[model samples]
Target: MWLEVLLASVLGFVIYWFISRDKEETLPLEDGWWGPGVKSTAKEDESIRPFTVETSDEEINDLHQRIDKFRMTPSLEDSRFHYGFNSNYLKKVVSYWRSKFDWRKQVETLNKYPHFKTKIEGLDIHFIHVKPPQPPAGRSPKPLLMVHGWPGSFYEFYKIIPLLTDPKGHGLSDEHVFEVICPSIPGYGFSEASYKKGFNSVAAARIFYKLMLRLGFQKFYIQGGDWGSLICTNMAQLVPSHVKGLHLNMAFNSRNLSFLTPLLGQRFMGFLGYTEKDVELLYPFKEKIFYNIMRESGYMHIQATKPDTVGCALNDSPVGLAAYILEKFSTWTNSEFRNLEDGGLERKFSLDDLLTNIMIYWTTASIVSSQRFYKENFSHGLGTLKHERLKVFVPTGLAAFPCEILHSPEKWVRSKYCKLISYSYMARGGHFAAFEEPTLLAQDIRKFVALAERQ
Candidate 1:
């Protein structure tokens, strides 16, 4: 009888083990050659070359000439930014760009930090590396890889870099001074564009992973918003062992509890791990969250479907390019900005900063290649990719800025990041948190890093 009981216990244990087996999922870490035509037989150069951002009289002259010749299309009476960028406002921005906006000074500001480019996957990867001038005694500074998203460049992080790198000098706590590395997404800014098709976020992630390894970093923290968010998430998935923590101002969702929770969650959010702030920001579901996504996502739809078509016009016309890109700066910064003349653009950002960001695409002449990134990633449709279903196992942090294009709750974020250590409902900011509210972003990054280090 005792022998039979022991055999029965063993059989039940085996049954439970079979039913509850966990999937040891991982992103496939692969390499590719992204150079122009054919893969070269010789090994690609691996040296890190110092790169300076230079603009000449000819470059500025050509830009001014284009702006001067841009044709004006008056906005419909009382029509604000409702129909893409208001033509009336474009004229104001054009006049400024043609007369006062100084590309030379902005270029000098961009070059203040050390810029370097190293070949990765046969493409030149451009990045800015800044180290803290003076770190607190007895502790080494942490390494952080900050990535910029679409319609943005390494310039987006310029304001926030100083705060993170030299917090003490900037009148902040020196608790977590970071050695920041901001890299331009391939095909954006000065980075070389991938020639062959099939260059998606995962491929970019693999290339960045190799970049980190080459930079002498065995492990580091990764943070991003926009495309930067997806790239950083992919890095965590591809090499969880190498990632100490992952922080994002944006959450990439494959479909989670967000749809279901929005309605019933208006009251029961706390029961679902969402704080009151999350509820306030997320509720009234149909207008704030639902319509907001639909309204703002038109650009995404075109970019994903027919990037080359629109990119052609944008590349040729500087005023058109500024209008197209700056419109995002207005709307994404505060959806209400769309209702105001000038799109309330100068309220939060200077023309210098806004125009400088537009200049990255214009000067590089990479608007077409930059837009193709959307096509390459979604050209095959989502879900078909492996990382879509996988969860990131590394320590995670999130800053859900109030005016983001769409809201993401803690419960929704935790579904993908199983080990989320920090989730902050940022006081005030929008899509470009670093650019709009550098101090808030810097404080949050420091907070998240401190939490991550405890483990």
Candidate 2:
């Protein structure tokens, strides 16, 4: 009788284990040292200092001199942006930068918001922290950390700041007022570049999490695209408890359920929870999925393997630098922009805004370090990291900008984000969703947070 009781108990336990298999896994929040030379034995200094963006007449003059000497290569006759940035168009842009663009005015614009720096893990981190101009009587504004990706900087969020912090003035409700923080990824802009090797997005996520803790916020929200998307995802995986919500414009989708639904996803989509819109957006798999990835991923291949080799020439020549960075802004904003002679650059952005982003990299001499990030993350291979294999349990939201380089169906996203609260197929935007569609992006963030609050 005793042996029979034990056998029955074991059988029941096995049945329960299968039903509750998904253990709600969590990633280890390991520590890291990103500074140069020997790891300091001393306790790292933790001080938050005020910072301002400044430029000198000498700096402007040097830029002008470089622009004056910029050598131009001839584009193929009748070739649009296909052969890269048409030199004919570049000559026009260079002329504008040298003759009309005012660096001093742009510098003042960058400083209009308060900038701050704090040391974490031996590196001086730079971030712009702006509070709502007016807060409710006794309520604290929601804290949102916005991180920028490669060939981009904290400048990307400048246009979207006011809309988020002071929505009522912009003809929107202020129900979800927020204090926005945009940080330059280390090695991308004002943030200190890493000296020791092996700094990747996971490390960045850990550092930014530390930044939030140091700022005295136990719970906050994170939003990002490009590298920002990956870093934010890692943070959600590492500390789902601390992140109140996770919002993204782009998803890496490297370790998703694509393997389970790549080819037959269209037919099986309903079973996979894909909507009718997902079918339209992700179908014609040859052109839309396979071909699009092949066409758009050349930059990743080179950056992942030989970033320094290509970046050296780009760093030396101002014109070369503009072409490499601006090309991405053009085709990435809308891939069809590649067919336009001028790359349709002015369609959604001003020359001043585009060049200002490029200037951040140029003035800081950070392109090489920025590109090295690709190699650092890819050196070990994609999806090999522990964080990549993990799921983000935090309240998640996705603003699926229609023209994004790659489309992620709700089903695919749901696989990694178990707690996905909201997903929208954004209208009239592309990969640079935040910069291109500030009003829309702000609204989606508000919607996502409202849902999170309700939950």
- lDDT per residue for candidate 1 within 1-455, as digits (tens), equals 56544544564455346423425477988889898888889988999999999999999999988987888998998889877799987877888888899999998999999999999988999999999898779988889999999898899999999999999898888888899999899999999999898899999889888888899999999999999999999999999999999999999976353445555535556644677787778777887888888889998899999999999999999998998899999999999888887788888899889999999999999999999999988877876777877878899999999999888888778767888999998999899999999989989999999999999
Candidate 2 per-residue C-alpha lDDT over 1-455 given as tens digits, one digit per residue, 9 for 90 to 100: 55544544464455345323445777789888888887788988888899988888888888888778877778889999877788889988998988898888898888999999988887889999999888856878999999888778899899899998988878888788999988888888889989888989988999999999999989999999999999999889889899999999887766653533546446656744678887787777787778877877888999999999988987877778988999988888887898898999999999999998988898888999999999999998876887777777899999998778888887668767888999999877888887888889988999999999987
Misplaced by over 4 Å in model 2 are: 1-22, 259-262, 265-272
Clash count, one per candidate: 0, 0
Model 1 CA lDDT for position 218:
94
- Indicate the TM-score of model 2: 0.93
lDDT of 1 at 228: 94
